[model samples]
Target: MENSISVVEGRTLHEISLQRKLWADLTAASLDFCEDLLQWSSCGNVAVTDTDLDRVVDRVLYMYVSEPLAYWLTGWFALACMNLLLQGKRDIEVFVFGAGPVAEAAILSLDHGAAHRILCVSVLSRHGISNQMLAAKLASKVHFKLDAVKDRTRLHRAGFVITATDAGAPLFEPHEISRNAVTLSLGIDDMPAEYFEMLFSQGGLAVGDDLVAMEARNVDPLSLYYSRRGLKLTEHGRADGVKNYSEILSDATLMERLKNWKGPASFLPVGLASLDVAVAAKIYEMLSITLSTKE
Candidate 1:
């Protein structure tokens, strides 16, 4: 598709070309970022000190946000493209409920998977900065009109509903949705038990960080963000005074178990894959490892 000039930040054709090239580089860079994360996480021989961990994470974010020198405009564009692809569902309609980085990430991931042109719905304050951006972005991509769901009627016959909103209460009651409909809660797992009960009783998917609740309701509480050191699942259900990744993982074995287990109620970590340069580099390293193992 010819790049839409309306959203293009440049005035002249040369400027536009420069912008496109920058964006292309951002996409490639994200791939490289992912690869760096995988290498640091998988490398056993390297001494993983606390200082090293700090540096690793900082480096990853620097690359992620394109901090000092590079602008993140291209990363955002590639992500936007991904969002369009996911909501391109044809056979069945998909609805999006939340409006943040994770929700946005999920939408982009869906696009990468070439989902059917799914209908998307999101909840936002009519005025919040994040919400407003989400609304505009969704408008740019999705064809359907954006409707504000004042009450429960918003759950109209959607095949799959993704709750990306940070609604403090149970977003939907158990019996409200169709039994066949899939409900993915892309929110923090520290919600009240009532939410889990509602989802479990009705048979739905809840994504969060609470392993205990996740186990109880058979929900999947997995986080997919990658850093140079390792993958990050927020420390939501853990105690204070935690030292390192080892401590976090050791104490959170139950959480890890919840992630590894396969069942309706269990949570699974669906690692986000980027075709960005950083991720590509990481994959190249992984391929090298696989080859070396074979040799």
Candidate 2:
């Protein structure tokens, strides 16, 4: 007896064929091979020959780039925030503005390692109730609060704040920021020009992953707005001040300097390709070891 397949099954088969062809082309070109294989496997493309799949896996192990970009980016940001928090007192209050993927990653990063030090976490978003409820389940020990962005008064209580939204305008003014707060701006235009001016004026530091790249793209709202207002970003030696993640991570004296900061310090991390590559390589190494152990 023969069996009949539904329209959905037929369509799925066609998709699988197209996906296999695409993966073959990508693998042949040696373009993001590990990422492509991971993606292909995710689609449950079982028709791929075991020999070819094994070869691809071996190549990925040799190349050492296997993890997703989001994972590493989250780790780097979290590490930077943790380092900054360590410079100050313990018992920190963290506030995340925008409940997007990046914000969720930051929340997870903070919760996993620093729960003991983190007294409370407040997530301000349009979907505050749901995010707050989800966060409650994820980390019961860390107190969670759901608040709207309009609650300006709550901003002053946060010791560590991270902005992870694509809003074209500033979310909060500089005056609302608490003294000695460690703020990391992950979104393109989530911070205002006044905030940058205030950070520099108060002898606090403002750093980025790559200021040259950021200025070249002209997507950073703070830089564009400040440039339009006749506030020279580079001429005032602020460009010289922009430091990358490696610099921040390697500098032994940075923590001590940060400890003495009298006002808020801001970090603007424009995602870097190197970070993604490094993270992928690390994950690949770990997976390779696990597979070898199983064999």
Candidate 3:
């Protein structure tokens, strides 16, 4: 596979080589694409995949291909990369909250981190053994220094932070995140409730790859709050505070709004189907090109 397929960013996941264009495509998708996905029958160019019992696909524009797991991870990685796409390149500190089996996603992020000019990295694993393993796996792939430290300040100072742990409680405070930090919590338990509230509060911004997915799962506090609030004029359901990643991609000023935001920003890539569909489409294209070349 390494000989035939191009490797994606990061020392791991050699089966996938994510082209930068995928980042641009993920962003370029508009609200219409989302609407199309929802409406189903009217969806012309866009593709839709649903796990729900009310599944809808009137006409298939594309078939799902590429390894499902690889494309899904790629899609999820793209969702987590809203900050990189919006803000462009910058030197950043990288922090990983859990480095056990969940370490792969954080490791996948290193490719983007390298592009962003990572200054240093600090990781906290389930037992610290995974920390060393993560560092060792990365030693040959990245040039930047990775220090396994329990320092809480690493989370505070990190320009890029990821939480792969589920400790049954929120891991960090809203203030603990730097004013402009980009954090990606793989699941719900990685972040505090206040951090979700911060998305509605001043200076903070909230972004998600797939609205249906974000709204469906309890990815974090916001998803749960959104579920319970549901069209109500509740104080927590501040419509103006949220922006879809596709909407931002179509509008530079919108992306800039989050990039220049004065508070902590997070990207919750929760939906399984959309990320899988978006990424699978792109990966299929890439692999098709490779196969055709061989023929």
Candidate 4:
């Protein structure tokens, strides 16, 4: 009977295959959890292999099928907005009209070259820093000021406006802004349904940035990355041998996305104490993608 099968290294080939399949199932489950966390679904494919499992134990390290796609879409839209404003004979004055997390993230991400000048206008209700303080911190390059209520005559003449506020209602009244101004709303969901009715009624260009949907896409990369390292849980105390970040992020498209992205982004194995190991793996993944391009 097949029951006579002998075990090698304390396990049989069938056991190894079964383990791999179970690991795959675990990977799928983890991806479901992350999808729940991100509130979205995969926009790209996730590939799992033994190599990916060697490095992560009881953890998922996600990678993106096309990590740069979102950024590309965002950058292109931003450039298009800039071009629209420039063509309308408006000076490149980027007005930030709210104080929120996404707004703060954009402020943190902005480099001097992205926009000629940035003006952060806020109401007294919002507390972060006065526009003046922001200008001082930004080396006197970015202009910051209090949000005026009596009249927005200054904003009406501006070239660009970004409503980065979390306000549930419209920030600017339709027909209240410059006809040539390019407007973007980042923090709101279903922006068109919510605020664009008035903007459209007034003939203003309204763009929506759905970051939550973007987060949902490609969340499974973590699972594939972790599974490649041979580090998932089992009867053993803890399986060893995990791949570095480089092994994960080095995918061709991912590296391209990181070319100008100086922000903090990485993949870490669960149950890891030190970030050093995870960071090392991330770098390795980035390099791997870069090297593949040359080949």
For this target, which candidate reaches the highest lDDT against the unseen true structure?
2
Better of 1 and 2 by TM-score: 2
Q: Highest TM-score: which candidate?
A: 2
Residues 170-279 of candidate 2: C-alpha lDDT, one tens digit per residue: 88888887866878877777787777767666776666555545555556654665567675444443553645334454466885776655566777666656445544
Q: How would you encode candidate 4's per-residue C-alpha lDDT over 111-159 as one tens digit per residue?
A: 3224434443432114535444444444443334334323355666555
Question: Which runs in model 2 stand beyond 4 Å of their true positions?
Answer: 1-72, 140-150, 229-242, 245-254, 289-295
Q: Provide the global lDDT of candidate 1 against the true structure.
A: 0.39
Candidate 4 segments exceeding 4 Å error: 1-59, 62-90, 108-113, 116-130, 140-153, 189-295
In angstroms, the error of model 3 at 233 is: 11
> How do the residues 1-295 of candidate 3 rate in per-residue lDDT, one tens digit apiece?
6566443332223212222333456534422133223232322333334322222566443354323243225323532464444355457777778765444445544553343466777888766687887777767665677777755767877877777666746778888877677777675656766776665565566666545445545555556656555642122333646655555556667666656555667776664454445645554454455455776
**Candidate 4 C-alpha error for residue 23, in Å:** 29
How accurate locally is residue 245 in candidate 2, as Cα lDDT from 0 to 100?
Answer: 39
Q: TM-score: which is higher, 1 or 4? A: 1
Ranking by lDDT: 2, 3, 1, 4
Candidate 1: tens digits of C-alpha lDDT, residues 110-212: 4433334444544443234665676676565544444444344545565555555456444555466545454454544323344444445544333322332
Off by over 4 Å in 1: 1-90, 119-132, 142-151, 166-169, 190-295
Q: RMSD for each model, in Å, please?
A: 19.2, 15.8, 13.9, 19.2
